[model samples]
Target: MSSTATPTVEIDPQTVVRKVTRNVIPFVFVLYIVNYIDRANIGYASLQMNKELGLTSQAFGLAAGLFFIGYFLFEVPSNIALAKFGARRWIARILLTWGALATAMGFVHNDFQLITVH
Candidate 1:
């Protein structure tokens, strides 16, 4: 009978954890700040956007409501996609898609377009 030996690898868990957190947290924090700014910018924009688009308070309110509704509807599916596709690829795709849509939002001239883009 022949005996085979397996080699054992040693890793420092604390060091690995510290390195990952140090590298990842800053990027994630920046993303959170950007997302917060994007959401809050709508309130700021409404001051000018309402008058320019001729959108009434009710219409604007509906659009705002729809935004949250859409977010709620997609949150689960997005999480599922993230799990399936992995975070790095999924995050890049989401950021690109969001950037394109946000840019498109700036070009909208009417309530329908605003609602659709937002």
Candidate 2:
């Protein structure tokens, strides 16, 4: 039997960094944009929604408070999934979930319902 030798190739760190930045930064930027837009719109939406849903200010305030609770609960599991599955696949999974959730938005009726959905 004949033994074959493998050659090692050295990659430039700057090129590697550029490539990673190109791939990773845009997605991170998008995540930030989506985050801020959601925050702003939720504030605007809650104002209108409180009037339409007949939510007491206290109830609306409670709903806003719970938003962070839900965010904290989901953030860790989602980040774990992102690390396990890779960004492209994890992002697609998130989009699919949010698409289904967006459809469910039509069915909410009252403060409790809206609070649970949010």
Candidate 3:
């Protein structure tokens, strides 16, 4: 009598890459592009918003500059924590915070309010 285990299926690496490229890369690229557009839309709006809000160019510039400050301060640690934890939960937290701050900027009545809250 001959006894042999049945062979398992094998997946090809090129097939996997092709699948990822076809299925995943477009969504990822679109998401990144949208995220950037959402963030920068504020700056584009600020051009008109500053005049309406009575914010000086310097104040608007400061507010815009602070976005990077927050990003810089939190980015590395947030990425590290995400690596230690997981992408889903970590990204959710980051996006939540980002969205909240972004929304709050719309509500600022003055530069002082903007500077203080942000």
Candidate 4:
């Protein structure tokens, strides 16, 4: 009988830690900040939007409610796609798409526009 030896690979713990800290940590932190900012900016705008748009209580409620709906619908798929594609490109795409939508929101002239867009 012939015996075959398997190749073994060795990695240093310090190298792993250094790579995580230098690469993964900063990317994760930036993504977290971007995610937080994107989620909160709507609330900040809502404060002024209610006044500027002369929105009723119901309209304000609807607007806020719809944001969650859109977020819920998109979040899972977007995140899955991000995981598949890698964070750099995926997050950039997400930011650009949401940023355009957010900018368009400012131009909405009526409740219908808000509902449709959100």
Ranking by lDDT: 1, 4, 2, 3
Q: Would you list the clashing residue pairs of candidate 1?
A: none
lDDT of 1 by residue, 44-81 (tens): 99999999999999989988899899999999999999
lDDT of each: 0.85, 0.77, 0.75, 0.77
As a whole number from 0 to 100, the lDDT of residue 31 in candidate 2 is 63
Candidate number that wins on TM-score, 2 or 4: 2
Candidate No. with top lDDT: 1
Write candidate 3's Cα lDDT for 29-93 as tens digits.
Answer: 65576578657876687778788889998997797788679769987898899899876566666
Q: Between candidates 2 and 3, which one is better according to lDDT?
A: 2
Candidates arranged by TM-score, highest first: 1, 2, 4, 3
Local lDDT at 87 for model 2 = 90
> Which runs of model 1 end up more than 4 angstroms from their true locations?
1-11
Please write out the lDDT profile of model 4 over residues 1-118, one tens digit for every residue.
9999999989999999998898767766766776677568767877777787788879978877988887889889988998999977886776667667766776888777877766
lDDT minimum window of 10 residues, candidate 1: 25-34
For model 2 the TM-score comes to 0.72
Candidate 1, after superposition: displacement of residue 101 in Å? 1.8
